[model samples]
Target: MTETWPARFIAAERYRRHRYAANHPLAIPRVSLTLDLIHSYAALSAEEYLVSRRASEDELAWFHTAEYIEAMQAAERAGKVSRASRQRHNIGNLENPYFHDFFTTPATATGGSIQAAEQVLAGYLAFSPAGGMHHALPDQARGFCFFNDPVLAIMRLRREGWRVLYLDIDAHHGDGVELAFRDDEQVLTFSLHMDTAYAYPFIGGGWRDWGVLGNALNVPLPKATRDGEYRWIFGQLWPRVLRAFQPDAVVLQAGTDILLPDPLGKFAISTGFFLELVEEVLHSAPRHPHGVPRLAVLGGGGYHPLTLARCWTGVWGLLSGRRLDEALPEAGRRVLQAVGWDEDEDEDYYPVLFERRVEAAGDGPPREAIRRLAGDLLEQHPLWRGMT
Candidate 1:
């Protein structure tokens, strides 16, 4: 039996102090809420919780351009940006708006992922709930990500001479990370996201876009993709890639936006399916020579606060080997109740959201598009073809 590795949850109180501009998809509380839900369950012990540090300018320079970093800092300082800076760096725009602590907030998140990577390298299973800002480019921001923490974290692992597999399950394509390492043979990037035709960052997720060295695989799921279809695709594809690549470490971007209730996500995935995905990854993750699982999990997009909290809390429970009580404790209930829902939205489903039980969005046979995509990838991709 594989020994259970100690788990660390990386977070910071600063996340609560920062907020995106009003009415933005990310304006809702994510990291802070997940921290509360886990604490409500008493799932984390003092030893397992690590306070996140802010990424210094030197650290951000790992994946970000120095000019872009300075632009972000200037925007935050002025609460605005020059037209040239805005256009050049993609800051102070609708997609990547400026707010208080714009640079520091993402820098802190980057720091969390960096810390998680460090912990994983030290032979522990670590998670940075504030990480997985995968869509930010080296010189620009895209898809609500201002800094690409996932890229930086992967780079940290790469410096140690470890081959890293970056598995992104965000609803949107992990375009930034894929772009960063597509030419590098040491890092393999696999993304399963909503098809670009129907999602944000609307390009570059086609199954055939396998990277320069065939080290990248992009699987775009159709809108409203159910639990069964997701399982079928992941089941058929992930194990094949794992066997062929045999990565020394795996970085999982577990974005909860794929959940059924998320307004921004069209898929009907359930919390149960999400946990199953994490569990499977944990079970099959590769270990270091010292028998420690070299896995670092990061959070991505999840707009629905209630669902995000529940999903991430369950993830921590799984990682820490704690059985969460199905009945929502009063403390957990209060945490859910405290969320400020948009006034324009209906509250009829409010009661259901408080319940800890989320029924699985049942799976069906894979659709023809999904089937064809899987077949094509397995048969055409060099990685799979080269596998014995």
Candidate 2:
């Protein structure tokens, strides 16, 4: 009989206290809300929960520069950023504001990702919902990301000499992570995101921006990409890349921003499709010699707080192999009721967001544009050509 590997969830209560500014897209509670929903449904057992630690300066240095780390710390201590630090580190800017606990928040998230990587290395599947800040650069912040935890997590795995495949399905491109490993042959970075024409960090992530070592693949989908189109492209490309890379481990940036109703993303993806994607990754992840699959899952850009909480809670359920109650328990309903939403969010879906499962809408006809893009990718990409 095959032995079952354990699945662990890494989180920290500090997330509830450390939040971005009010106007920021990330200001809404995400990790905390998800945890509340999980607790309400009794989805996770005590043994499956792992408290996250704060990443040390040396650990942050794995991907971030020492100078940048010091600048962030100083800014955080003062609860503000100096003119010079703002210009140099891009911290005090409107995009990456200097908020309370600016440094500690990302550092803690980075530490959670490090823990997730350690758990994966030890033969357990791990999920870090507080991690996946994939837009921060080595010395600067961008796209509301203060630190690049996904890069740090991948770096942790690389320390063990593991060839890691970084898969990012966030609506926005994972520019920081892709750029960090662009020249490294041991790491393969694949990002399926909204086309730069319509998305933030509106550069690169195009077909022509394949990494220096041909270890990067960026699939830029058009806005309003529906479930069928998304799945069709993923089916054609994901397995092909997985086979070509043959990585020892897989790091998934499971960003719920790709789902429908997200203010930042235009994709029409649903919770059902999102769960299917996660299931595919779990089953297809490369296993170690001891028969344990090496996989680390991290959360990314999800703006709709209620939707994000529901999606991530479902993710934990899938990981823990729990049959979640479809109806929202009274406690779960209370949790959802307490969540604050922006004036821009549609209130019509508020009631259904309390439920554990959100069924996907019927898939529409496949788009010819998606078909053409997939065909070109398979025929012209260096990885695919080499495989052929």
Candidate 3:
């Protein structure tokens, strides 16, 4: 958490095809709001920026199926689709309805994520709030994501011989990441998402889907999970994961979707709790892997504009090792208002969503739940197992 660690963030000046329609939560003021807030905080250098562009066919060919990419681009450019594109790629599907230049936004997110992995390899703590599209497949887009940035990034890192510990705190399971690395031993992906029974992406993220070499870990929480419930299971699960993976580094998908007001989730976790989880991960996870630098990607499931920025700001603050300001600065507010204003739906948006209350259990999870779940995991394995 040093300024020396280089808190890199990625965003673009190119106009992203921002929304599908009015009132869709994904259509709200998000990534740009985050960029505005970070700029206001003055944590990043204006000169040291990284923005992603529409990925070339060559780059897309690396991870995605070429036919799918061709159809996607063709449909996007024409601003209409033929039956073949729709039938084959599910582009016309309700969740990810085709839009102009569809490849541009997700491609930016994808390229930025790949760049983040490369930067982390070069010893910088780079982040792309645009990445973490955990739903896209090699052949088709799923959820709202047309390109799976996290999966592509992990694939790139694994190709470089890095033993990766991929951790996600998004309310939705990183289904695509799990499937992409489902059988790979070089990468260990652990997701703590809302259980499939009552959540989006209702297919995977269960514990039983563990990988071929035992490299996957999925712990699903029921709806409305409080701070105690989430931290409880994660506390038990993470130690075992890091212990067994013995990673060279860690990648965290710190999606704000776990927040209660998040349009996609029912979890009631707070911003402070989110910040604490980050603190613990940055401090604890690396030790087992010999103190490798960890890179984080902003993941899914946030719609409340204010909540999204505030939650992400905590991550920025923690990485900067700075105190969280009690109030949102006007500059941050202006940026949020700008995104929301252009969308022209919610005019009265502010960055701090929750009513500003800290949990009684201090920064960690409830002592009782932690003691109960972690006791069993600890009893099964010694601390040094994680380090080795």
Best by lDDT: 1
lDDT of 3 by residue, 1-388 (tens): 4532455676776434476666456766677667667777675566556776555667667668989888877887888777888788878767778665676767877788888778777766666777788878889888887887887777777878888888888888888887888677788777888878678777763555665665667666666678876767777667767666678777888888887556567877777788888888877645323234566555555776677777776777666556667465677666655654433234232222323422322234444633553454445333224453
* Model 2, C-alpha of 263: deviation from truth (Å): 1.2
Which portions of model 1 show Cα errors greater than 4 Å? 1-3, 342-350
Q: What ranges in model 2 sit over 4 Å off? A: 1-4, 342-348, 356-361
Write model 2 residue lDDT over 1-388, tens digit each, in one string.
1335679999999889877778888889899999999999888889999999999999998888888999999988888898998988888988888778878888999999999999998988899999888999999988888789999899999999999999998998889998899778999989999998778888774886787688889899988888888888899998898889999999999999988878888888888889888988887899978867789999999998878888898888877777676687899888877975645345555556665455444387668888888898888888876675
Worst 10 residues of 3 by lDDT: 343-352
RMSD in Å for all candidates = 1.8, 1.9, 4.3
Better of 1 and 3 by TM-score: 1
Superposition TM-score, candidate 2 onto the true structure: 0.96
Judged by whole-model lDDT over C-alpha atoms, candidate 1 comes out at 0.88
Instruction: Score residue 157 of candidate 2 by CA lDDT.
Output: 91
Q: How does each model score on TM-score?
A: 0.96, 0.96, 0.85
- Which parts of model 3 have CA positions greater than 4 angstroms off? 1-4, 15-17, 285-292, 337-388
Give the C-alpha miss distance for residue 81 in model 2, angstroms. 0.8
- lDDT on C-alpha atoms for all candidate structures: 0.88, 0.86, 0.69
